[model samples]
Target chain A: MAMSDLYREHILDHYENPRHHGTLADADFSHEESNPLCGDHVRIDVKLSEDKTRIADAAFSGEGCIISQAATSMLLESVMGWRIDDVEQLDPQHVLSLIGVPLTANRVKCALLGLKVLKTGIKLWKLQQMQHSA
Target chain B: MHTQREFFDVHAVRRDFPILQQRVNGKPLVFLDSAASSQKPLPVLEAMERVYREAYANVHRGVYALSEAATAAYDEARAKIARFIGAPAVENIVFTRNATEALNLLAYAYARAFLREGDEILLTELEHHANFVPWMVLARERNVTLKFIPLTPEGLLDLDAFERLLTERTRIVTFAHVSNVLGTITDPAPIIARAHAAGAIVIVDGSQSVPHMPVNVQAMDCDFLVFSGHKMLGPTGIGVLYGKRALLEAMPPFLTGGDMISYVGFDDVRWNDVPLKFEAGTPAFVEAIGLGAAVDYLSALGMDAVRAHEAQLTAYALERLSEVSGVRIYGPQDPQRRGGVIAFTVNRIHPHDLASLLDQHGIAIRAGHHCAQPLHQRLGVNATARASFYIYTEPSEIDALAEGIEHAKRALRIS
Candidate 1:
């Protein structure tokens, strides 16, 4: 495939001007992950609503390839008002569809890095919540 | 010098490598990842095939004629490699799976046996993971201390810092003869002199250097030198570990099984002699023969000419790359101090993105930490795109790489 096919206009836009591209200071939980193969890193900070049932806001910060940073930007923008449980149920295929590009096996990791960090963060936060309640 | 240059024609050399004569992504393939692993020449490939077809048997085990022939070929390969590196004796060269396995062998057989608590092992920031992680693992298990020789702002090893890091407690000093990422060549003579004065034995990781330049372990006086075959026009699954005669004789075997033992006993085992003691089981005899053929190929070309060719190519690459705006090249600006590897980043483009863009143009370059994460962290960059050269590389390939980078910049919308 040509470079243009992968780095489309929308992907470039998200990469150049990422949405929610910084940490939320009063975030309920945060998690950071790195793709060891390429040294690409992504950290996700999420803030829950007052009722703690839905994600009020989510921001991601990291340095990496265009697909990773842009995918994270696009992912955060799509899931801003998503229910916390629904976000947990988000699968890897959903992330690939969100990327909207055919990726080689190696690059699939780059595109999914954001979702991996976000899902892992939510899982850890849930674990902490359960501990506090107990 | 001009006559030598004329004698070693790169176009003639390029013809020997069959893989270079192909198209990728509808463009002529421009391979720039030789530092990762080089393309094999016809001689090496033919040697391997001839061995499989004519003389195929388990080496050193069979008493039959075919086995003897295979054994003779394997031993001849060892002798060729020994001569290639200026090793004193063929007995000093021990074969392993690759450079990584060679380094691990030393860590297990030497460091685990000799290193004590609080003993310091000095290493450089320029080491690839193959040289670094083994020592790190040893330190954790043996309660040893690991110290690093810092790098200068120009990415060269800080010799002053190296001298300061040397101490009486320093038991081992190991560093790469050349940095895989920066392509900076470290002169081992002075490092070895000082390390010996401090009572530390020096190990040189020659994975990058040996394939590019003339190396003499005897002249350098290093205790151990490790390099892989695949990076030097040989097939995979074969590497060399050259040690001083006494050192190899003294160190216990790292891996033990059938061929390595002189006699196997349930109560006690008598190990075979030095080189054989280290090599166990059915070795990669055919691959070793291929490596022997590779050594012959390089020897025929003359390493001095190979070095001269790469130096000229590197100088030209640096100049061409510099003309492109916003291109930041790593390593020493002077090509004399570096090998033919150029690592760089263009504008704000991520290396992976740039690599993918270049792939569309059929230009292959490495994009990552290059297995030197500590050095990448020191440079304050996650990754860089690297283009490395070898015997068959042409000047037009460099021009193609530079043009490809410009094309990549435009495609990524980077001004």
Candidate 2:
């Protein structure tokens, strides 16, 4: 039972003190998702650029397992300056690689919770944009 | 059959479950999740296999030799289960898919048939979704109101609030005999007496209580009680709903099909007797036979001895788990009021993480809300890790759980 295979030092560091782990007071777009079986919740709030093409700032707030929370913090760090389209292309495998561990089938949902929130937030942001134009 | 002396012996009991001998994650398997679903003993498995191999046929409709043999086997199982639970007669026991289906049957046939608008249904905060949801549906459809007995901070039922909630309008009161998550063994005698005095019928979800304790439906004086076979070392897809025969006789059939009918006309029909009227189709006779074997195994061990074994194990687990810094236990701390199940949360370690870590040590435990979301909400925690004991569980497993928690804290870099 090599615990290091799952909880490496960097993963623990991020889990102990998550980065950008707070709610944006006035976010342009936000989304929340939860793993009902494990009760792992993840919410992402993003401030889009004026041109609406790039993410100007992103923050997250939720309580979950170390893998979920740390992966969320890492995910928040990776998408700060990315184009909305590239962020949308992020998939479960990409999140797996970001966490750098082989999660069992059950725990895959925990590692991917953050990415789900981000993708959902992007869709909501686009929806809000459409409503604003109208 | 296990010898009476060997019955209380944990080592001998462990040998009965073949699954316990295997290794998981390079460590000896430590099964601590019996409360979720118990592992089958050799006898239970052999009994089901015997039925399928030798006496396989649909029950009641067949008149041939094999069919009669099958029917006899199935009927005998019902009688055994009835005697095991101290029901008045075999006619009072109805077989359903599982305890969930059993609860749904009572809700539809009994509660839906009898209750009316402005009536009230009282439930507790600790009900599993199976027990809680059906009544909620009944309440909505019949224009009735549903009230809850608030949970005390100690994770026991608030009996004071329960008294206040019971009114003349209360037609039914349903709750768990033992909470699946809290492991709190609620004494239902008071509740049953009070509900009966208030003209309300009582339904006990004995899914948790029936497996670990000696249950006598007549002595309890409840109108109905339900439990699943899978949780008691039998096969899945089989459960028992024990009701007073008169109540079962009065309620309309929940499901209508080939087997449950006594006679039929083009537009009108005559249903079967007490239990069969509720059992609609070809019931799981094979699984029911398996459940009978499970009952035999438990009876041979003696329920009083089983209860004592779990009490000893639970006390040891509580004492051992408390030694782990920052581990907060749920339910009554006193072993007298709790069963073998222990639900706890370690500081800075989510239950999911802790469960996974324990898995690495070949220790199986349950994490999350355990299908009691309302209870979790009331407890103000998203989830908690649970380690439950069975006859096969030993004190050494609790030590493994404690070590697993320490290892998890270290891996997570928590103090």
- Which candidate leads the pack in TM-score? 1
List candidate 1 segments past 4 Å from native. Answer: A49-53, A83-86, B1-7
What would the TM-scores of all predictions be?
Answer: 0.96, 0.96
Interface RMSD of 2: 1.3
Q: Please, what are the lDDT tens digits per residue for candidate 1 over residues B87-203?
A: 988999999999999999999999998899999999999889999999999999989999999999998999999988899999999999989999999999999999999999999
Off by over 4 Å in 2: A125-134, B1-7
| Native contacts, share recovered per candidate | 0.84, 0.94
Please state the interface RMSD for every predicted structure, separated by commas.
0.8, 1.3
Provide chain B TM-scores across all predictions: 0.98, 0.97
- Residues B1-415, model 2: lDDT tens digits: 1112333767887788999999999999999999999999999999999988998988897799889999999999999999998998999999999999999998898888899899999999999999888988888888999999998888899999999999999999999998888899999888999999999999999999899999998888999999999999999999999999889999999999988989999999999998899988889999999999999999998999898888888888888899999999999999989988999999878999998888989999999999999999988999999999988987778888999899888877787
Every model's DockQ:
0.80, 0.78
What is the alpha-carbon lDDT of model 2 when measured against the actual structure? 0.90
